[model samples]
Each structure stands twice: as C-alpha cells, then as structure tokens.
Target: MKILIVSYYPLGFGGAEVSMKILASGLKKLGHEIIFASTGHYEGYKNYKLRNYRKIPFFFLRDNLLGNELIKIINKERIDIIHSNGYYTSLAVLKAAKKTGIKSVVHFRDYALACVKSTCLDSSNKEHERDTYRHIFVEYFPLRWIWEFYKWSYIKRSWKKIKQFDLVISNSNPVKEKLKSLGIESTYLANPVDLEERTKTSVKELRKEYKIKEFTILYAGTLEEHKGIYELLVTLKDFLIKNKVRFIIAGKGSSYFKILKYILENTIINAKMIGMKQHEEIMRLYKLSDLIVVPSIWKEPLPRTILEAMQNNKPVLATNVGGNIDLIKDEYNGYLIKNNEWEQRIKELMKNKSLREKLGRNGRKLLEEKHDLKKISKELEGMYKKILIKN
Candidate 1:
C-alpha cells in the first residue's frame, strides 16, 4: 500500500516524531511504500516534501489549498491510506483522504483533543480531580466563561474533523478513555521502545566522560513549570546539599532560564544542567543514572523517559499520576509516590544498593514483557491491515 504520513514536522527530536519514524521504517520493512507530507524536512526520509500550512487571517484558505494539494498527491501516488500524527496536520490529511475515497488513520499521542491546557492541570499545576465545565471555569478566572466556551467550541470542532478518519489510535488507555468521554471512540496502544538499541551506550565510558563520581539521579524532559521543574528544585535543594549525590537535569523550555537563575542564586552545587542532549547521549546518561526521576505535575499520557530508564535497568521514581501508576508498582519495578516525598525516596534508594539493583532488574523485566517495540509494531501492523480490509 502507498501511504502518506502527515506530521507537523518531518523530522523532530520529540517522542511522537521518533515513534512515527520507527513505525514508518517498520511499515517499509513490511513492503509498504511510505511518503511523508509535512512542514519540515529530514535527510534520512528520502520521500519527504514540505506542505506548508497557512497562518492566522488566512487559516481556512490555507487549509483548503493544502487539502487540494493532498488530494493531488493521493491521486498521483495512488495512495491507499493516509496516517496523520498531530493535530495541526490531521484536518488537511483527513479531508484529502475523504475526497480521494482512501482510508485515513489518526494517532492521539497527547490530551490536546479534550483539554485546552493540554496537560489537564489547573493554574496551580495540579491535576483536576473532576474535569467538568464548572471545575474548568473556576480554575481560570477573569473571563472564565469566555475561555470555557472557547475550549468547548474548539474541542467540538476538532471532534467533527477527527470523526472523518477511518481509524483513531491513542498511545495510552487514559488518553483513549478521555477521548471516549468526548464521544470519540479510539483504539488504545501503548508506546514502545527498542530495548537493545536503547541500551547500546557503554556505561563505563559514559561514567568517565561525564565525570560521574557520585550516585546520580537523572531528569530528562522539558524544563517547564508543568513538568514540576520548580517543585523538583525546591524539594531537592537542601537534600542535594546534605547528601553525596548528583542531580542531572536535561532538556530546555520556558522554565529553563528560571531554573538556571535559581540554581546559580541558591548555589545548588550538587545539581548540574546539561541543557538538551540528543537521543544517544540521553541513553548514555540513562546508563549512568542510579535512578530516573519524572516529576511531572500533570497527567502524562506516557513518558518515553520512564520506558527508556526501565529498559536501561534503572529504577524510576515518578509522581503518582497518569501512566506513571500504570508502569510503576510501589516497591516492585519502581516507586510511585507524591512529589513532596521524593527526598525521602531518593535517600532510601541511595542508602540501599541491593534495593536499587532489585528494582532495576524488575523494571527491565517489565519492559521486555510489555513495552518492547517488536511486539507493538506487529500489533500496529495488524491494526492497519484490519482497517484497510474493513474499509
């Protein structure tokens, strides 16, 4: 089958982009021809071509033009299906697929379909117990009703477009359930990782390269408020000073400058920021970590970091929310606790090498049994074929 994969960017370093690339390769290996229709370019995918969308003041005109262009590509390429990965590219792809009478698939990797805040967190960076209209209105003020109405309008419009697709996939059960609540039925499929490839880095060499002389805890994600960067810093500031440990923070965002300023002003000597590192470099860092911390204040669909850490045979300490609870069984594969209890958890793990090793081993076992990429790829292949036959 000739498939056109639509995405916001052709090449990106994010988890969704990486997962799509891996999926494309697996499909290609299965003898399917893949063509990319995106706004950006990457050298590895030879069939990549830019399809720029229109900006504000000309949104509908741009979408119409893009949809027509996609229709042209579908006819010219004899495309059998269109697979879109992000919200920005879904409308044009689905419209084109409908026009050409070809099947279309859409993947929901995040909470954008139902929540305007995306993280599903309130102004205080706490997950709302009830995500109802009243709760949303009361959380954000000034013109709460206007914003609330706008979110409803946006989600309703999005759902109308999304319903056009033949198949919709969600990366986690929580996201799938969230979509179901909005009257959108979706297939649940968890994200997968290449276990062997992810742990290829030489641990000894990495330790030497990074000058790792102390027990290290790694945090690799967007350095933002929603990600609990500020909360993490505050919780670990005094603990880091009193203990023989190192905290390595990676990735940059709006909170990067604020974190840097705090670190400098407070003289958090044991903590260090490496900004952003490529996937391979991140894997190497994961290899050196005694434990990985995912301090997200929001409900993450599923973070690739947790899987990667587990695959590398490292115990994960994550907040008790979203997919974190799904992966970590307290005192089993990993620890799931509140953000405030992080200091105590870290100290306990640091003081007990046997406990750390046991948790790490269990985490790897969980990764192989459930989150391996090969198994997930086959499941996806089946889903695609099923959709094709059904249509």
Candidate 2:
C-alpha cells in the first residue's frame, strides 16, 4: 500500500508530529510504502534514513501552490491512502484528496472542534475570561481565530470530503465522542510512543543526572494555563515544602517565564524549570521522577506525557478529566485526583513511599499490557489494512 501521511510541521518535536513519525515508520516496517508530506522539514528524520518513505513539502499554507503540486504527487505516486494529523493540515489534505479521488483519513488528536475557545477552556491564560469578545466575535479574524471560530465549519467541510475515505480516526474516547455528537463516525486509536527509546534510560542514571536527592515530582508538557501548571505549582509548593521533596518542570510555553518568576518570589519549595529539553532528556526525566503529574484544568483528549511517564515506570497523578480516567485506574496504577482534591492527593502520595512504588510498578505493567508502542503499532497496522481493503 502506498500511504501519504500529511502533517503541518516537521516531525522533530510536538506530540502530533512525533505521532506521525511513529505511525509512518510503523506502517513502512509492515511492508507499506509511506511518504510524509509536510509544510517544513523535520530535523532528525532525514528522508534517506527511512525505509520505503520520502518526505515531500506540500506548502499548502503558502498560497495553495503546494496543494496543487501535492495533487500532482498523489497521482504520480499512485497513493492508496491519505492519513492526516491535526486540523489545518487535515483540511488541506482532505481538499487535495477529494480532487485526486484518493482515500482520506483525518486523525483527531485534540479538541479543536468541540470547544469554541479551542483550548477546551473559555478564555486564554491570564484573564480566566469566559464569554469575552474573543470568544464571541467570530468574523474576519486571523487564521487561528477562523480555525477556532468556525471549527465546525471546517469539521463539516472535512466530513463532506471524508466520504471519499474508508474511516476517520481519533486518539481518545473524548475526541471520538465529540465526533459522534457532530454525527461523524470515527475509530478510536491510541497514540503511539517509541518504547525502545523510552526504555533506554535507566532509573538510577536519570536520578543521578537530575540530582534528585529526594522524592522528585515531575511535570512535562506545555506550561500553559489550561494545563493547570499554576494550580499544580500552588498545590505542590505547600506540599513539597512540608515534605521536603523536589519538583522539576520540563517543556516550554507562553507562561514559562511568569511561572518561573512566581516560583522564585512566592514559593520556597525546591523547584526548577528546565525549559524544553530534548526528547531523550525528557525520557530521562520520566525515569528520575518518583511521580509524574498531569494537572490539566480543562478536559484533555489524551496526554502523551502521561503515557511516556507510565512507560518509564513512573506513577502518574492526573486530574480526573477527559481520557485520563480511561488510562488511569485510581489507586491501582495511579491516583486520579478531583479538581478540589489535588493538594490532598499530592500530600497522600508524598507521605506513602510504599504506595508510590506500588503504583509505579503497576503503571509499568499497565503500559506493557496496553500502552506499549509495539501493541499500539499492531492496532494501527490492522486499521490501515482494514481501510485499504475497504477502499
């Protein structure tokens, strides 16, 4: 099968980009010829390095010239299936695929369509402003605004074109539910992780590298307001100061500097903000972490950070929202704290070392059973084959 994987950015970073890389590589490994069509080039994944794969620039956003050129590639390559990740790129690919009469599959990785605000929140970070002009004013705004304002418009547009494809795929149940509410059918697929790269870092080495003397709590992912970084900081500051534990925050975001200043001036907790380390370094942080926290205030689809932490044998403490409940069996593998119970839960995990270790072991077992990349890749392969056969 000749497959074309469409994505907006390069595959060096970001959850969606990494997912495309994994899925494309996995399909290629299963004897399918894969080509990555993107707006820009990814840093690490050179075209010559991949098997039965090529990365082509479509430049769909740059005046639609690339979209027409991509149509030419689609016909020339004799592409059988077109898989698109995220919203903007999916819209473009769906358009091109419609013209080429190729099978198109749009994979939903976030809540881009369901929420009007699109962050799954009513407003941006600082204001906590709900139902503001930004939320209500929906006309002639920038591309970002248009995407969020008329998400349903694009969604309906894609749906019209999607009839050419065999299926629509979503990474989480919440996303699938959203699609269903829109009267669009979609298949549920788990996001893939490179388990081999994740498992390469040893716990001991990770601890030593991070200088983790005490029970270190780790948080990775964007330090945005919707991610509940501020709330986590407030909760962890009091708990960690009392328990003498350390906290390390990884990843970059709009609120990174502000959060850093808040920690410096307001809290005495031993905290450090290591902004956006490499992927390998992030895996090491996961190994060193005694517990990982995904304290998203809003409903998240499925966080790759939580999956990576679990795969690294680190217990997770996430907010009881979105697809988190599906991944975490509270008290069995990890703690699913309610919005109000966050501080109490952190304190409880801090006090009980045995409980933490038990949960960590259980999480590792769960990862092997359900969230491992090898298992997920097989599921994706089956989906690809089914779609191909149907087409």
Candidate 3:
C-alpha cells in the first residue's frame, strides 16, 4: 500500500524522527510505498513540507489549509493510508484523511497534552502525583498558567479530533493507558530500532577519538533540568570524586551551561559534558559506554536512549516511571530505581563487571526479540491492513 507519513517537524535529528525514518525504511522493505512529509527541517520519502502552523495566526485557517494540502497530496499520489507521528500534523492529517475518505492512524509518542511543558512535571520539575487539574492553578500561577490555560484549551478542542482516526497508537503502555483515560482507544506499539545497523565508529576508535581512558558511564539526551541530569550529578558527586569512572554527558539543552558550570566548579567529579552528537555518533558512543543512565524525573512515554542501550548490550539504570518499568524488569535486565538508589546502583555496576555483562546481555536479548525494526514493521503492516479492511 502507498502511505503518506506525516510529522510535525520535517527531516530531523530527534529520536522520534530517526526512529520514524527507520520504521519507514522497514515498511518500504515490506513492499509498501512511503512518502514522507513534515512541517520543516529535513526531507523524507518523497518529502513534502507542510506550511508552518506556528506562522498562521488563526486556528481554523491553519487546519483547513493543512488539510487541503494533505488532500491534494493524497489525491495526486493515490495514497492508501495516512500515518501521522505528531500532535500538530496528526490533528490536520486526521481531518484531511476524513475528508478524503482514506485510512488514517496517529502515533502519540509523548505526553504533550497532559502538561504545558509536555514533561508531565510540575513547576519544581517533579512528576505530578495527583490529578493535573487539582494542582494546575495552585502550583503554576501568575505567568505559566496563562500559557498553560491557552494550551489546555487548545488540547481540549483538538483532542476530540483524535477519535476520527481509524486507530491511535502509543509508543508505550503508560502512554496508551493515558490515552485510554482521555477516552481515546489506542494500540501499544513500542518504538522500533534496527538491530543489524552497525555504527561506522567502533569502541576502540571512539575511545581514542573521545580520549576515553577510564571506566565510562554515558548519558545521551537533552541537558534539560527535568531530565534529572542535575539531580544525578548532585546525587553521585560524592561517589564520582572517589571512583575512577568517567561520566560522559552527550547532549545539549537549556541546562548546558548550568551543568557545565557545576562540572567545572566541582572540578573533581570526572564528569564531562560533550554537547549533542548526531544519531550515528550517539550509536558509537553507546558502544563506548560501559553503562547508560536515563535518570529522567518526568514520565517519559518511552525513552529511545534505553532502547539504544539495550541494542548496544549496555545495562541501564533508568528511573522507575512510565515506560521505564516496561522495558526494565528490575534486576532481570536492568535496574529501575530512584535518585536514592542511583549512587548504589552505579557503585554496584561499576564494581561488578560480570553482573553488568549479564544484565547487558539480557537487555540485548529483549531488544532483538521485541524492539527489532523487522519484527515491528510486520506488526505495523498488520495494523495498517486491519484498519484498511475494517474501514
């Protein structure tokens, strides 16, 4: 079947973009024709760039124009199904698909609707323990609430559009359950990774290239405050100063300077902040890492970093929240612990090479068995076919 894959951002470097490219390729290999379109940035399969919704002042105009653009493309390309991967694009794409009388399905990759920040964290960067509405005005007052009120209104209006799609997909069970709570039925489709794709850079070469001379623990993601980088550093600073381990942070964000200053001022944690690397470079870094720590304080729908670590046979110590629990079976494959356990888990993993290897192998097994692109592609194709037939 010919498919039009829509996304908010065009050709990009984010995990979702990279994974979508991989997924598109997998679908193409299965004899499905794929045309990729985005709002901006890079290109995709027969890539088309939709108009910038942000530039449009009025909401109805944006939706109608985007939907018209999609309708024209669908008619011209004779597309069978529309698979949208983001909120902005999905909103417009669903409207277009409904008008065109074609199959449409959307993938919800993050919890953007739940919170204004989309991290599902409060003002203090802590996860919301209670109902979001109960704490919204009480916590985020004065400034943040105005923007949040606007966002809440936006989501409330557009959310009903989701029901128009033939199917909805969530990348993790937590996200699927969240969608279910909002009265939208969704399928649990975990993100996919290519198992056979080898990185151009090797561990030995990466070590030499990056000057890795000690035991390394890698954290590859945005350097945002809510990512738990600051918390991780503070929690492990005392342990880091005493150990020979090198903590390599491979990403940049608003917290870049903040994190760097702390590393420079402390002067003894042996933690180095290497600004963002391309996806290919990150895969090589994965091979260089002895262990990866995804210490996100927010409810991550599903972090691709942990999936990458699994693909590279690296054990992980991710926070116990959201999809982290789904991928990690506690002591089986990796440890899903809190900040209090970070230092302990790091220390234990650092000391025991055999245990690390054992856990890493288990993670690799899990990745190959469940997260492989080939396997996931088949399942995706089945979903497309089912929706097409059912309609």
Candidate 4:
C-alpha cells in the first residue's frame, strides 16, 4: 500500500502530529510506502508542502495549492490511499482525493468532526463560552455571522465528504459517538505508543539532572487551562506547602507564561515548569516519575501521554472523563479522580510506593495487550487492505 498521510505539522507540536509520525513510521516498516503532506513546517518525512493559511474567508479555496498538489502526487506516486489526519487543509485534500478517484481515510483524534468551536463544548459549558463566540468571530472574520454559518456549514458539509470516504476511523469511542450523532458512522481505533523504544532509566540520574529530592510527579501535555494545567496548579498549590514531593510540568502552550507567572509569584517550591521536552525526554521522565497526572477538564478524545506513561511502566492519575475511562482500570492500572480530587489522589500515590509500582506494572501489562505499536500497525494495515479490496 502506498499511503499519503496529511497533518498540520511535522513533529512533536502536539498529539496529532506525534500520532501521525508513529503511524507513518510503523506503516513504512510493514512494507507500505509512506509520504507526507503538510501545510505547516515538517522535517521528518518525504513531504509535499502546502502553504499554511490564516483562518480568513475563503483562504483555503483562494490561493490554494493543496488540491492541485495532491492530484499531482496521486498520479505521480500512484497513491493507493490518502489517510488524512484532518486539519486546515482537510477539505482541500478530500476534494482532491475525490477528483483523482483515489480512496481516502480520515482518522478523527479529537472533537473537530462535530464541534464548530472544535472543543466540543459550545453553550453548555461555561468554561468555554467565550471560546464558542470569540474564537470564530475574532480569529476568522470580517463578517462574524457569515463565518459562523460557514463554520457550521463546513461541519455539515464534511459529513457528506466523510460518507464518501472508503474508511472513517476515530481514536476513541467518544469521538466515534460524536460522529455518529452527526449521522456519520465511524470505526473506533485506539492510538498506539512506541513500546519498543520505552527504555528503563536511572531515577538517580533523572533526579540529579532535574535537582529533585522527593517523590516526583509529572504533567506532560499542553499547558492550557482547558487541559487542566491551571486547575492542576491551583489544586496542588496548598499541598506543595505541606509536602516535599517534586512536580515537573512539561509542554508549552498559550498558558505557559501565565503558569510561569503564577509559579513565580506564589513561590511554589515543589513545582517546576520545564516547558516542552522532546519525545525521548518525555519517555525518560515517564520512567523516572512516581506517577503521571492528566488533569484534563475538557473531554480529551484520547491522551497519548497516558499511553506513554503506561508504556514506561508508570501509573496515570487522570480525571474520569472522555476516553480516559477506557484506558484506566481504576486502582488496577491507574486511579480515576473527579473534580477537586486530584490533590487527594496525588497524596495517596505519593505515600504508597508499593501501590504505585503495582499500578505501574498493571499499566505496562495493559499497554502491551492493547496499545503496542506493532500490533496496532498490523491492525491498521489490515483495515487499509480491507478498504482496498472492497473498493
């Protein structure tokens, strides 16, 4: 199979990009040819570059090179399928795939399929009320209502394109259900982690390098309030004063400066914000940490960080929301906490090393059975072959 993977960026910019890289690499290893198409900058694959666009009216349609370039690549490469990790250039790619008579697949890793705001929370959730109106109106506007109509129409319109595709897969059940609500059926395929490369690390070396003294916890994802970084910080601020544990917050986002400001102003000694670390660094941290905390307030479709932690033989303490419920077995592989319960969970895990180790082992066992890269890649390849055979 000759698969052309499309995404927004090349590398560890976010979860979607990382998943794309892993999938492409795995498919290539399985004797399938891989090519990449991106509007944003990428450095890791044989890529076709399309100019990144601003979220303005008809920007993708006007001055767009995506469709033509995709058509050219489809013909020249004899591409069997265009597997798109949807982003700004998705509509263009789908249109080109249709025009060229090639089968296409889109893997929805988030709520972009149903939500106009893309976070899946519109008027119901107060936390994202401003996001519902402000983001679309301010970011992509001259006429707000037109943009609003276009955004919603695009969502409905994408449903038509989705039905035309040979295969539509999602990373989690929540995402699949969201699509189903729009009358578009999808297959649920879980995300894979690089299990082979998850090496055991020396905790002493990691502690010395980071200048940490006590039991360590890790928060590895975007530093945004929606991601529950602010909530994590606030929930643990009082606990920091009482405990000698070290907390390392990794990843960068719009909220990085705000988090930094808070940490500085409050003199939170036990907490350290290391910004964004590369993949290898994150895996190493995963191995070194006592527990991984995923305090996501939003309904995360699936968190790759949790999978990574599990792969590294570490327990995850995450909110009981979204696809997290599927991954964690609660007191077996990991513990699921609700609102205002993160501090309590952390304290329990911090004090009990045996329980942490036991949970860590259980998590690793689960990762092997479910999210192993080799196993997932084989399943994905089988899906591709089935689509091709049917088509």
The best candidate in terms of lDDT: 3
What does the lDDT read for residue 243 in candidate 4? 81
Model 1 misplaced regions, further than 4 Å: 10-13, 51-54, 57-59, 128-152
Which one wins by lDDT: 1 or 4?
A: 1
Candidate 3 segments whose C-alpha is farther than 4 A from its true place = 11-13, 40-44, 55-57, 129-135, 141-146
Clash number for each model: 0, 0, 1, 0
Look at candidate 4 and tell me the lDDT of residue 299.
Answer: 80
TM-scores for every candidate against the unseen true structure: 0.91, 0.84, 0.93, 0.91
Compared with the true structure, the alpha-carbon lDDT of candidate 3 equals 0.83
Ranking of all candidate structures by their lDDT, best first:
3, 1, 4, 2
Better structure of 2 and 3 per lDDT: 3
Expressed as tens digits, the lDDT of each residue in 29-57 for candidate 1 is 67778888776754455454655554433
Per-residue lDDT tens digits for candidate 2, residues 1-391, read 7887767666445777777777666666677787777655644332322111123322234315445656776887888877777765565566677788877788887765554445546544422212333544542246565444454454445555554456688898988887777667889988776556654656787677667788788888887788898777876666666767788888888889889888878775688888887666777788777889888877788888888877776778888888788789999888898756767776777788899888878877877777667777788878777766663
Off by over 4 Å in 2: 40-63, 124-135, 138-159, 162-164, 198-201, 267-269
Per-model lDDT: 0.80, 0.71, 0.83, 0.79
lDDT for each residue of candidate 4 in 144-174, tens digit (9 for 90 to 100): 6676766666666666767877888889987
Q: What lDDT is reached at residue 70 by model 4? A: 82
